[model samples]
Target: MQNQAEIQKLLVLCGTHSQTAFEQLYQQASPKLYGTAMRLLQNGELADEALQEAFVHIWHKASEYDPEKGSAFAWMATIVRYRALDIIRREKSQQNRSEAMANEQLALQQGEDFFIHELHVDEDQHLQLLQECLKALDSQQRKSVLLSYYYGYSHSEMVTRLKRPLGTIKSWIRRGMESVRECMQR
Candidate 1:
C-alpha cells in the first residue's frame, strides 16, 4: 500500500501521461485493488480482468482525480469494484439466458409431436434435419454448443469441463451456432 500523498502525487503525474508514474501507481495500488476485486468476484480470473480494466480506466481518467473529494486509492478501488460488479451482472444475465434455453429445450422434448404438428412438419423429418445440422459441425463445436444450450453450462463452466481455454470455448460455441443456423436455413 502507498501513502495517500504519494498516491496523489503519482496520480497527478499520471494525469500528465507519465508512463513511469502510471507504472509506479499500478505497482503501488494493484494489490489492494485486486484484493477488492477478488472480494467482490470470488474468482481469480474475474478479479484479474477487473484489476486490468480498472487500471486502464485509472490511466485514462487519472486527470479527473480530486483530492478534495476523496483519496486516490479510494477512487481506484471504486473503479475496480465497479468493474467486478459489471462482470457479476453479465454472468447473471448469461445464467438467465441459459435457463431460458434449458426451459425451451425441455418444452421441445416434452411436446415434440405437438410442436412438429403445429409447425406442419413431420416429426421424424424435423428431428433428422436438426440431427443433420448438428452433425455438420466439427466435433468440438458440436460438443461446446450442446453443453452450453442443452446442459445450461456457462462459458466458464464449459472451459473447466472441456479443459479448453475460454476464448476457444466461446469461439466453438459461436461458430457452431452460426453453422447450425445456416444449415437450418438451407
Candidate 2:
C-alpha cells in the first residue's frame, strides 16, 4: 500500500541501475524492512547485516517485484526476510545464533512465558510505540529490553553479558515493561 510511485520508479530502475531511484527506494522503506529484520533476527548486528543483504537483493531483484501480487513493500519485505533467514541458515556464526534461538524456544515450552510481551508486537505502530516507551526508560533499562525482547537474551545471559547483577536485570525488565505499558496506554 505504500511506495507505489517509488516502486514504479524502482521497476524502471531495475533494468537501468539508477542510483537515484535506488537511494529513494532505500530511504522510503529501509526502516520498516530493518525493523522487521530486527524483530525476526533479534540481534542488532544480525538485523543490520540482514538489512544490508536485503538491500543488495533489492538492487538485484527489483525486476522481479510484481505489484499485482501485492504491494511493492510486500515484495521487498519477502526478499529481505528470505535473505535474513538465509544468512542465519547458511553462515556458521548465524547458525550458532539460530541454535541459541532454538534453545530459547525449548525453554519457552516449559510454561515459562516470561517473554510473552514479545508475541504481542505485530504492527509498525507497535514499533513506534516501542521506540517511544524505550526512550522513557534509562539507558541500562532500554538496553536490557532490547537485548531480551529484540535479541531474546535470557535473563541470566543478559546479566552475564551486561556485567550487571541478576536482580538488576530482572528489575530492568519488569520496570521497562511497566514503563512501556504505561506509555502505550497513554
Candidate 3:
C-alpha cells in the first residue's frame, strides 16, 4: 500500500519487460510528468514525445533504484524531468540561442516569471521549510539542485553551470538529496 510497494510492483514489470505494467505506470505517472514537460518546454507535442521517452528510460532504469536511495516517486520524477530537459536542449538549442537577439526582452520577462511564478512552488511556508532544510547542504549541493530542479537542467548542464566535473555534480546531487531527506525526517 506504500509508494515503495507500488514502485516495486512496477519495477518487477519493468525488469521483465511486461507490457501491462508499462501501461499501468504510463497511465499512472505520465500525465503529471507530461504536464511538467509541457510547462518546461511550452510545446505539447514535444512534451508528449518526451514523456514517452522518459517512461521508456524509467522502465530501463527502474532496477537500478533502491528505496533507500529515495522515494520511488522522487527517483522516477527525476528521471522524467531530466529526460524532458534533455529533449528540449537537443531540439531547441538553436531557438534558445536566437532569443538573445530576436526577443530578448520578452524572453527575459517570461524566463524570469517562468521560474518564479510558473513553476508552481508549493507555497511560501513549504518553500521556507525546504529552504531551511536545504541549509544543511553546502553551497555546491544547493546550487546543483536548484539549477537542476528550478531551471530544469540536466546533470551535464549542471556540470557546465558549476564548472565542475560530472562526477562531482553527481555526488553533490546525491549528497544533497540525502541531506534534504534527513532534514525532512526531523
Q: What does the lDDT come to for candidate 1?
A: 0.85
Ranking, lDDT, top scorer first: 1, 2, 3
lDDT of each: 0.85, 0.75, 0.71
Highest TM-score scorer:
1
Encode model 1's per-residue lDDT on 111-172: one tens digit a residue. 55333444566757756677678767998998788788765787887887779999999999
TM-score of each: 0.62, 0.46, 0.46
The worst-scoring run of ten residues by lDDT in candidate 3 lies at 110-119
lDDT, residue 93, candidate 1: 76
Evaluated at residue 105, the lDDT of candidate 2 is: 53
The CA lDDT at 167 in model 2 is 93
Expressed as tens digits, the lDDT of each residue in 1-186 for candidate 2 is 245776666655864788888887888788898988987788888889999998888888777776667877778888789878876675655456557656655654664432343455545676667666776799788778867886667787777778989998999888988898899998
TM-score of model number 3: 0.46
Candidate 3 achieves a global lDDT of 0.71
Q: How well does model 2 score by local distance difference test?
A: 0.75
Q: What number of clashing residue pairs does each candidate have, in the order they appear?
A: 0, 0, 0
